[model samples]
Target: MLLGRDNMKFSNKIVVAVIVGLMSFSGVVVAEDINTEAIGNAIGNITSEIETAKEIQSEPLDKVRINWETIPGAVSYRLVIQNGESTSKDAEVKHFNRIPNNGYELDTANMFKAKDYYWRVCPLDYDGNVMGPYSAPKPLIGEEVNPKAPLATTEFEKMAYSPLYPVFSWIPVDGSGGYEIRVSRENKFSPGRYEVVREMTTKNNVYYEEGGYTWPGHYMWQVRSQNKVGEPNTEWSEPKYFDVEQHVRVAALGDSITHGGGVCNVPPGYAMYSWEYYSQVPIKNLGCSGDSVQVMAQRFDRDVMPFSPGMLIIMGGVNNFRAGEDGWDTIAAMEQILAECQYHNVIPVFVTATPINPGLMSKVPTIEPAAWNWKEQQQLLNQWIKNQPYHVDVTPALTDANGNLKAELTTDGLHPDHLGKKIIGETISNYLLTTFPSYNLTEK
Candidate 1:
């Protein structure tokens, strides 16, 4: 007894032809064997709506999205989040691929103001075969009110202070992907006064860590949250204040290659050692291994731009070169970093990477001629910096007479050893003296 031509069971026996259709016109794959598993699949068909989206909080840019159960036979989903109130309708139509990733997220930019939003889904097969159906029009059902940044927040009324460092607390908000912690010297300022500092992505409230001391002055700070969606910037919370005395603030920003991975088992990295030897100013390290010029561009505002330092010593490009990051275009990213510093009135100091020891090449296989190749990229990056205003080159001080890693000078193949760091430090100190000779040297 045949159920049907495609094996669809009607009564139990009578023969008939049934077409299991694919929603897309390109769907013409005839699998005579049939997908037995799809029959009575609990995952259900495409048109059937899964659980309604919950916790749909409003954020900047009408960044509306939904969380739903996976549909049967679905390899990915078509998500359409839209607002229909104003002429500038915000819409995010993306197809999220299914992967073993823990979860998924989307950035919904280009949103409208004050309007109703409509959303739906199209479950698709591996070939994006829509599961025969489309969801009924589901209105995101929103108020047409213009969205604003999260209301400013602070942890407490009475603030505590530390001479070495100070910490600020802030109440947490959900729609926020990150925060901007602001600190002010006095009282009233501008609409967005205080230094704008961004926090990392999180699930809870944010607390900012103060790395070192201050001028023992009364300081007030605040927090502003942000989503990766529309306004790449964040709005700050109300202000909080604290007091401290005096400490010259200084820090370093570089790539992992500068974090002193090379034979560095001690603190006060070679950079700090250099700072101590050259000037009396203390310094901190801000290097991340394998970081690229592009990533640096994205983080420039967050990393270099915020500090508002008198001087910023930047050392990197080894990872970029080693990663085969295109040399011609890498400077574009570097230029952005420079622009940000210039905008903030911060001095940009360009330092070449300490020379690479050939023997160091044996340790890292991914890097070919690892040490030698890295040196060339460092030099090329410096050459690009030569024409920039306010740019100070620290190359002559770190490299050997023959442009090779000094065999007797360096302790390790890759990084500066104690003795090597000392020499490097002296060189930079001398340059600083010759260039800015006015910097007060506190030490004898």
Candidate 2:
């Protein structure tokens, strides 16, 4: 049966034409048949989304390079680098290239200031037709690595009792090769006053365990970082002050929420009030943001016990809950911390985890949907806390009827604001006065 050209499938027509041509050339010198399998495989080799370096590679501007894997069937590649922070793509397009290789070495001509950039690659065929899909956008210096000293967090103006070696810690700097920590008795960093010089290869956030800080003396410490590329060390960080007080009346230890947050609409978002505002006794704020119960337990000796506080208020657990831990896990960690306090004769006071709201939870981009389960664990932990002999319940005064944070008391659902801080401070103050009758708490 004769088939009309329009009626025949395209692939069938190609096969019929090829067979007819072979038959006609049977008696003549004809080349071998075209390999359809090879053609199909070649087309299949054009893979989309070429693998590339981390959106932000930890390198300085001059050392940065745009790198990607070579794609099959790709004769060339077109690259685009744009300012990630720009409002329009054209305004920030710093470099555009149709290069022959899988990577591009950047020079000052296409370089930008210390800022974030976006980059992508599109595979091209021999004639410049795009072969496969453009890669997903990647950041060039998505986040700039910290080029200098990490800020020292613990032991800042803190006084540790003698015989207790305090741990020192700082915020981790991205892309740092290591850190050099220096401690000196005199603030001037003179020749003889320096006590310790240690280089840390571990992540900077963890406390340095080598102790030797003595009591009834003033000490200062600073930190600087080695560049990731083996470059010279960054400038020394500003000094932080610490004193070795023989006796500590009180200390507040918890996660970042305890460090004082929800200070938005106010400046310096983390802390709104200091230790002096919360307690009438000589106390220190030993809170670090994002610390889980396990983290607190690990640092108990260096962060909490060194103060030799007569009363220690423990408020934490939300981070653990958010990380998928339940009430029992949190309680176990709490028991360990409480036991440590007991061993040292330091009184322990338990503070309930603050509340969270569904409305406010979504505002934080990094917080996942699983965070919704945080409240249930928090409630269970808070209830268990209240059952303890000595505890302060912030949940009752801090929550709304629906188990969410009271709107007026918090700037974010997690951390309290002025109103909530007042409630907690007053509650702790009352507990301290009633628990320890002889201690004088006049402001110094």
Candidate 3:
């Protein structure tokens, strides 16, 4: 039977009748005889499916869909839509700043009066300033169409250390009911040329593989959208390439700063915001966003032991200090991390915590202001860091005369932007090149 919107109410009534009949068959229905748990579960499943169908049917259709390729190093984008052939500022009908993704869907019912329109996009830095030339203006066609394939957003190629447990992610399609991801060992994708490693469908735009790759080798992945009826709505996206290496020379472990990304909206997956992206030498990113010193110490074996690198760069405690954690407690957690590294035969390298800017922090509502004594706590931590066997001081370059993070280098004030990240990367890179020249070989 076709279970569609028209028949859903009728179907629900029938289901209710059946349930009543089953219960009424016996004067007093026993839980054991009716299998109440199974019936309840079945009803729940049906309700969930019905709700999903309703959601898909209620989604609004876009009047026009605009898509662009992701630009490297861009924290966000500025999208301009004009009324005529000219994409100039004077002819602009609409302009959007800090668009976090490569695509946008516009509802032109009331917005577009002209038959022809043009749109262009320019990548932006954390401060909303244009970072590159605008994309060639493309005609914006106003028409209803099927959902388009999602754009893969992960920068797998730039990752210094491919996680044993990898997360595949992509931009969400405007009208998609769900997504399907396919991974293969070969790039060709054809039946004979490619060996399919894994294929799965999900309602989410991101998927985490708990059981990661068993063997290290080259891998390629792509994603596509599905319609409400579970049919393919769009073709597969351009495949992203990445390698699963068996080992690495260096790895970095810490919080969001070590993980990369900034400017509030952008994530570490963008690569350009990653310090590892700017590093001359390859350093695996073991950084996790929102991680505290205690959490880092807790997850060290699970997250860090897989790659088994010769050196592990540790930079954390910002989250701790900002949240008002005690300096000695934070240091104790760091000491645990250092001890674990020693046990694993990995050289522990310390990176001084970068200062925070409260003025900018207040600007982004999502970011909490640092503790009143965060600077004092940071000084305590940095002093301990300086006393470590191997350390890299990034504070000097990022701090101002008053010891606050330089205003120009960050957007959110907590996470540094590309320029600041570049400084940190290059500083660590130079330190690695000078101190451990043997591990400085170019990553394949």
Candidate 4:
């Protein structure tokens, strides 16, 4: 009996020892897990703090200034800017990378041109590996205007016409009691040829009609402010230039792409409507961004007919395709627009629809991917355009072997860059050169 009890006691002792060992092992594992979790949380907090955005101050054409809290260990900050939403670091503007200063001024002392620019700043360690996260990119917009002049907003730089009645307007200047507008046949503001047709009050900024001008005449106009409480005449706004022609002017009509949206590479500024870039003919830009075929048809009379275009260069249908409208509807709109131009003795020049990059388009949150049927619709529309007598196939010049746009030619998936614009201009210019020899042509 004694022996049996001793055996039982020894067995109990062994069982307790085994249970204690297992508990100790679990305790060690729990401690290790707690330590790992704490470390991960600490790292996450540090990253978040590092990524905080800095305050940004920007003035038009003056400077792009940034201020941020100094990081404890950061030796410097790297700054990068690209043409609006370009996504590629390769597009970063020159002399703008990893600048030693926390504050940066772009373009030396010269003004930044009008453009949509994206900028970011990130801290760097001594080794230059990017420390923490980059500031969420912020967008900056620059506008094109003479800061000192009585700014003329529209119809200042392009070909102007009457019957539609070209309107001359300027923003009201402060302390100016009245304004004087002088129009001249020549650029030199000689007294004999210069006519002061109207003196306007501070209340009015527009010239309804400056009479006595012949058609097809080049004209220069200037405005001078009469200050209410200062010197009699301030410096004249840089002479704004325009041309009045009786004959039908050539006009390029399409959507925003034609309107010169997103077509910038050189300086930071708004893209001139592509027509403005085309020197081959006196082509006015009638392209409104984001317009579908139907919308364009509605505005044809208001925008195109008034200019009395000798030839209306048309490129559209992408917006319609993306909008999920019937392909036939787009064709019908084009047919109607063309017919109107024909009725008025305006020749119709149809350029095939530029290809869209759905892969690239899908990545842009603002742009919706085309439906599966979008390509088919585009193909049909393009084929139909090719069948036309005056069709200019810009597709071949702008597209790649895989049917994507030549990457260099476009800033976004849809809009042409400088190279793309050059390609389009060359194709159209060549077409017009061969097809219409009688028209006056200029190449730049």
Candidate 5:
């Protein structure tokens, strides 16, 4: 016996009170006028409906996707989802001990049911210990929005110095065979509005534009996922804007250290981790991660020619040394880079290679161990760098007496964290101000 639709309009408590009042009134009149059994059934149906409404209101979402803010100095994160009556750390339905990024998509098809679910995340250190307390449990309430195209993850700086070779990266879509990227002076993205458009198919998640934009102006770029047959799978991502300027006062060119990023999970695309971000002076970052001295030399023509900066800060050879390349070979490559700078009338400022800690490197799975003779090779290269015409030695500030990178300054041993990058930037900033007093005159 269910309550009629019209009866549901009344509050359950009010309806029950009204029924009790009617029964008392009926005792004073003809009791045969009202059916006692029908009244009892109506009361039972109303009670059941009230309980069902509470359940529906309490657990509204059928599926959920979780996202959280990135914690500084966190190497990874711990995510836990529990489904139970209370928000306790019990009845764990799913637990991820380590998540590299700030987001996770739960398997709704198999994992979620008509139950109340709560989720929380905690920042973790390299050793997997919790760096901070778990976030307050958040109600997991909505279906994950799955886009057809890959999601763009690169965070572009608002302004960049001339010779812009921006790195574009994205989270790969589950079924995407490849991706397409477009850059334009206009955001409309019409046929002729594109300034630089290239469709590339690569399994890797990043792309470095070799033919970079030279002119200083505003630019817009977007990316989309594609299938193996070259058909578009997703709509183009929302356009991201960045500005490029000509006639920059200074610029840093090197490998991952100069390219920026640390703490394992963050990528060089983030400006906060770059030394340039902390410097008092304005310096364009032309650094690329995973680049050796040889690769830097090879790309010099394509990367540096467009901007043709007034001054170029050269820092490299760590990649070569860590891979066991000979010291002289690395030195020779640096010389080649310097010779090119001199020919173009660009002031070449050499930044000495910082040392590495094998112990720290071993802890990060993505970072390979330093070669047996890496220290010897690094010393040789640094010594040569010091002899260059204009140089900044950040080694002394970053390394210990044993010539190893200070553990406090780095998370992965190879790349310096924010604090270490601050030291490097300040050191270089002080040097530039003293050596070239007019260096930052053109800074805007």
Candidate 6:
């Protein structure tokens, strides 16, 4: 009996040992698996989150774009942006504050001319435990150019300018041809709902259309460019206003200088300066960079005549400096532009050519000589112009003694800066206001 009892005890001891061994093995496997409680602890460890947004873009005076990285398993995203003062985190521009995102406008000098941004994603499980805002998103950049409202390039053809239907025809914006025009008389116009007057196949030409009215007397117009993506870019042209019959129409015509080669900083072309922006009269720029008198003469009928402008401001003969056509030849072309205007009842104002840096004068590979020098032939032309009925000389007022372009006026040895534009425009404006008492062609 004692032996039977001993055997039973031995068997019980073996069974107990086997059970403990199994339990130890099960404990290791359980440690490798994730549990709900473990995930909760991980979520509690996070100290920061998207507040203002990971990436942002703002137009200097108008709009803002906000984007963010996604949460690991986020079903949706909450992108909040705030304006005011930042306190701690990227939350400065967050919606967390009472300041609404829509309340602020971008300060041009403070932020980037064009802003680019990026973000990542967060994955969320069925349970709200956020795994991660996991991946780096592609980078995006804000467009740097904020095209100011476009001005009309032409005058009221009928001469009866109306607040109700101010007729305007402007030089068509390239790539923007065949586009939809958005007119905002008083309020900001919807760019998307604009009427499609132009189409995909349109090219360079004048665009004349009846724009919609926003207020009783207020009116504004803009044309947007289109492509395969549909409405592509909306850098607005200068905005035009129609008030009274007293409005003036002026067209600045010539080679590249009128086109703004030096001032613009774009594609080696000129920049638009205050001349067109500040002049009270409607200014039409008929300047094409690197054009010759021959080319100018060819396009003259189309460029100078149609505006029915009160005045024609011509600033060239520089590109004609070394042009195969020199002296009387160059003068003859200038005369042609003037005679056409005079015949059309348009006033002709002559601008002495702006000085050229050595580099630009050397543009033609085969030629090299003077920079900014208008030869005796050119001088004869200028003298002859002064003698004409409609021709007026507007250079001595702006140029230094010796006829050299004022050094202070240029940005690069060639292009004029804001200061230069001021000088040039003031000279021209004063001339118009003084000489041609009826001159009323620019923005006032």
TM-score: which candidate is best? 5
Tens digits of lDDT, candidate 5, 1-444: 677766664555465557667776778545445555566688788889999999866743433446676687788899888785355656677788877766665655455452466788899987899989988776665424344445566667533442256777665455567788887774344533557644555655667665556665667778887788878877887777777765566777888888877888677665666788767777888887788998899878877776767888898888999999999999999999999998999999999998999989998788788899999999999999999889999999899877899998888898898788889988998888889886553364
Candidate 3 residue runs with Cα over 4 Å from true position: 1-76, 87-90, 93-98, 105-116, 122-136, 140-147, 163-169, 177-217, 226-236, 438-444
Q: What is the C-alpha RMSD of each candidate to the true structure, in Å?
A: 21.4, 22.8, 20.0, 24.6, 7.1, 18.8
- The superposed Cα distance between candidate 6 and the true structure at residue 274, in angstroms, equals 5.0
Candidate 5 weakest lDDT stretch, 10 residues: 142-151
My TM-score estimates for the predictions, one after another, are 0.40, 0.49, 0.71, 0.50, 0.74, 0.45
Comparing 3 with 4 on TM-score, the higher-scoring candidate is: 3
lDDT of each structure? 0.48, 0.62, 0.79, 0.61, 0.76, 0.46
lDDT score at residue 352, model 3, on the 0-100 scale: 97
Encode model 1's per-residue lDDT on 160-238: one tens digit a residue: 1121233343433435666655556553444334443333333334333434333335566655566766343545544
In candidate 5, which residue pairs clash?
none
TM-score of 1: 0.40
lDDT of 4 by residue, 317-388 (tens): 989886677788899998988888888888889998887777666655677777667767888889889988
Candidate 1 residues lying further than 4 Å off, grouped into runs, are 1-250, 257-278, 364-376, 400-402, 409-412, 439-444
Candidate 2 residue lDDT tens string, 1-444 = 777777655655476457547755785433355455553444345322122233344444653456576564354688766666444567456545456545554443235553566778888654467779877777765422333445555523422222133445554454567776666675344643655543444444444334434344566667777776655466877787566665567777787655553423221111223322445554566666668988888878877765677778899998888666878999999999999988998888899887766576556565554365777898888888898888987778888999888876654456676567767777777777786667665432
> Between candidates 1 and 6, which one is better according to lDDT?
1
Worst 10 residues of 6 by lDDT: 96-105
Q: Lowest-scoring 10 consecutive residues by lDDT in candidate 4?
A: 263-272
- Pick by lDDT: 4 or 6, better one: 4
Q: Which one wins by TM-score: 2 or 3?
A: 3
TM-score preference between candidates 3 and 6, better one:
3
Per-residue alpha-carbon lDDT of model 6 for 1-444, expressed as tens digits?
Answer: 455878866765565455446655778434234443444444344322332243332224333323232221132332233232232346323222211111112223443422443322234332334445433333223322333322234333312233122223433332343454555434326533333222322232233233212133344455545554555555555554443222237766766555542322222111234344334444655566567766777766655555456777777776666442456787788778777777878777777655444443344343355534454545655676566654445456445565545655543434555556655656666666777665443443
